[model samples]
Structures are given as structure tokens and as C-alpha cells.
Target: MAKPITKIDEPILTEKEKQDQSLKEVLQDLSQNADGIKETMQLLQELHESGILGAINNLVEAKEQVAKIAVGQMLRPPVTNAINNAMAAGGLLTEMNPETTKKLMGGLSKGLQKAEEGLQANKKVSVFDLVKLMRDPDVNRVIKFSIDLLKGLGEGLKD
Candidate 1:
């Protein structure tokens, strides 16, 4: 006689297991949220303080490569006209303006570095510190400034 697979006797998860599972779930949710909010550029300072910006730097470099290459890429999906329009609208202004572009990229890179750092730091930081950092007005202002500066540089490049 063999026990049925549907409801074999299985011990309940212990408290430690439950705690660990809950933490994992919460961390997953935070990671998803962080990815969605990476554009906001709010966590730069903390992330730079930590050392995980190197990983983000790697991702940025990889994206640059993809943008530059079309090796064996399927062309079944033609580039949409709308995307073409957007690219024209955002054509390289840094073409003859390397200095401005360099400064812009430098600042932009630092801001993103912080965000990557934040994601790494989040694993070790408490919920309270996270909330405080998220809600801080200073952080909000800096992100806003970054957004404006980037937008302005992009707009300048259009001519």
C-alpha cells in the first residue's frame, strides 16, 4: 500500500521558514519597484557609497553595445515609423558638442550609479531608512534637477 501523492503527510513550514519566505517575497517586490523607478534617480548618493554601481555600469555598457550592433538580429519586426520619428526628434546634438554631452553623461552616470547602489543597499538597509530616503524632499529635488538638465540637453541636441 502506497500513500496517495495528493495529500501525503508533510510537516508544516517552521517559523524560521515562514520568516525567510516572507522576507524573500518582500525583497522581490522591492526589486520590481526599484526597476520601475530607476529613472527617477533618487538613490544615487547612497548607491555610490556602497560599491554596486560597477554592476549598473556594466549593464549600461552592454546596452550601448546592443544599440550599436545588429549581428544576426531578426528583421522580421520592422522598425516602427513612430520609433523612427522619435529617433529623428532625438538625434545626436552632442555631435559637435562633446563637452556638453560629456558633462551631461557624467552627471547622468553618477545619478544612475546611486540608484544601482540603492538596490544593493536595500538588501541590508531597514524598512524605516528606505521609507525615509524615498520620502526625502532633498532627494526629490535632486532627481527633479537631473530630469530637467537631461531634458534640456536632449532638447538642445535637436537642432
Candidate 2:
């Protein structure tokens, strides 16, 4: 308290001291994460044994060639077409009501089940049987749905 402090002196570390300090910190971290390091080493050993590590190394070494080949493959007509079709299908799916799609899928499953049962029965359908089937609530409902779907499709096509 007799003299007022005018300046502070900070300890300046040499390059060698800085490197040594860094090594000490790294060693401390390694010791703390010994189990994780061991697990990683084991995984690396397994990958090396399986030739995957070598493959990965090669891939890294020839990254430009690999990228070119990948891009070439992706740019192929069939691949591009598939990607485009998938995008279109995704767009169409988004526009469809989930509830309606779910209902349609459920109905389709039930219809398939009935068709399978009919196949097992091996029954022949006559004109009278067709008339009788047309009167069936399930058949009628499906016919109505099909007609409505066609009408909507036609309307969309007009646009």
C-alpha cells in the first residue's frame, strides 16, 4: 500500500515450454480417455483386418477420381430419370391427403385378401354372379371409388 502499482509483469513462455505444456495437456487428456482410446484402437484394428481401412485409405488417396466416377454414375440417364421420378412421386404424395391414402391402402389390402380367398375357392363367375356381385356393398363402393378416381384424373388431365 506504500507504492501504487504502475505495471504488471506476465510470464512469457518460450516455444519449447509452450510445446512441452501442450504435450502435457495432451498426455493428461489421453490418460483421462484411456478406455475410449482403447475402444477406438480395437475398432481400427478390426477395420484394418477386414481390409476396410485400406479401402478407405485408397478412397481418400483417389478422392478426385472417385468423385468423378460417382458424379458420372449419378449423371447417367437411368439414374437421373430415377431421381426425377422419385422427386415427382414425392411431390404427388405430398399433394395427396394422408387419410385418403391410408383408407385406399386399407381397402386395397382387404380387396387383395378377398381376391386370394376367391382364388382358393376357384369358383367360376357367371353373368348372374356378376350382377349379384355388382349389387354387393363392397363391390358397389369400389366401383364408385374407381369412377370418382377416373373422373378426378380426367379433370386433372384437362388442366
Candidate 3:
């Protein structure tokens, strides 16, 4: 008859053995992610070499002071005005029709170019010249557009 097989009793690990087991597990993990660890080390090295790490460390050290300064600057009249203006512009842009805005911008650019040409030519506009220009189709179109724009602005203000 064949010999009967028996289960062995589990043995308790000693402190050294436990430490060895943990080290082995850590080594296994490091081996598995060796490439990632290497890339991370390289990135860290580059950051350190570029002095960015030191700068970041300093920034962290003075975070509260830096924050206070930034807040103070933001609270200044000019900075607050700029922020408010930017927000207002953003709201205006959101409400505007994209196509109409694009057309208006294009027209403004062309008008600027014409104005530049007039400036370069050193031509002075007299009252008679102004009356004559008013008769021009382009000038008449722009005038009508401006009047309509003003009327719309007035209506918006009333609301």
C-alpha cells in the first residue's frame, strides 16, 4: 500500500524573516515597474538640474506671503478694473452673434487700413470734404450701421 500523505503545520515567521519577506515583495514591485521608476527619476533629475525644484520649494516655503501679495495686487484699482473689464468683455462676447462679430471686426480692420492710408497721405478733411464723403456709399453704409448700433445700445440701456 502506498504511504498516506499528510499536511504540514504552518510555521510562524521571525522578525528578520518578516522583514526579508517585505523587502522581497518591494523588490518584486520595483522590478515590475523598473521602467516607470527610471523615467520618474530622470524627470526629477531634470527638474532639479533646471533649478525648478528649488524655485518650487521656495515658493512653497513663502506660500502665504506670496498669496497675500497676489491678493493685494488683485485688489488694486487698476487690476480690479482690468478684471471687471475682462469679465464684461467675456459676457458681451458670449451674448454676441459670432458671424455678426466677425463681419464687424473685418469692417473695422478695413476702416483702420483706410484711416491709415488717409493719415499717410496727409490729407486734411474740410467741412465740404465731409459733406462729399457723406454721399459716398461706403460712408453712408457705415453711418447707417453706427446709428442702428447706437439705437440698439440705447434700447439695451433702457432694459
What total of clashing residue pairs does each candidate reach? 2, 0, 0
Alpha carbon lDDT at 10, candidate 3? 89
lDDT tens digits, residue span 26-133, model 2: 999999999999999999999999999999999999999999999999999999999999999999999999999999899889989999999999999999999998
Least well predicted 10-residue stretch by lDDT in candidate 3: 2-11
Alpha-carbon runs more than 4 Å astray in model 1: 1-77, 80-90, 94-96, 123-159
lDDT of 3: 0.96
Evaluate residue 11 in candidate 2 and report its C-alpha lDDT on the 0 to 100 scale: 96
Over 1-159, each residue of candidate 1 has an lDDT whose tens digit, in order, gives 987688667779999999999999999988989865674565775566675677677778798676556542433245455667667657756254878778768877997998899798776767898678768986776778879979999998996
| TM-score of every candidate relative to the true structure | 0.28, 0.82, 0.71
In terms of lDDT, the best-performing candidate is 2
* C-alpha positional error of residue 81 in candidate 1 after TM-score superposition, expressed in Å: 2.8
- Pick by TM-score: which candidate is best? 2
lDDT of candidate 3 at residue 9, scale 0 to 100:
78
lDDT of each: 0.75, 0.96, 0.96
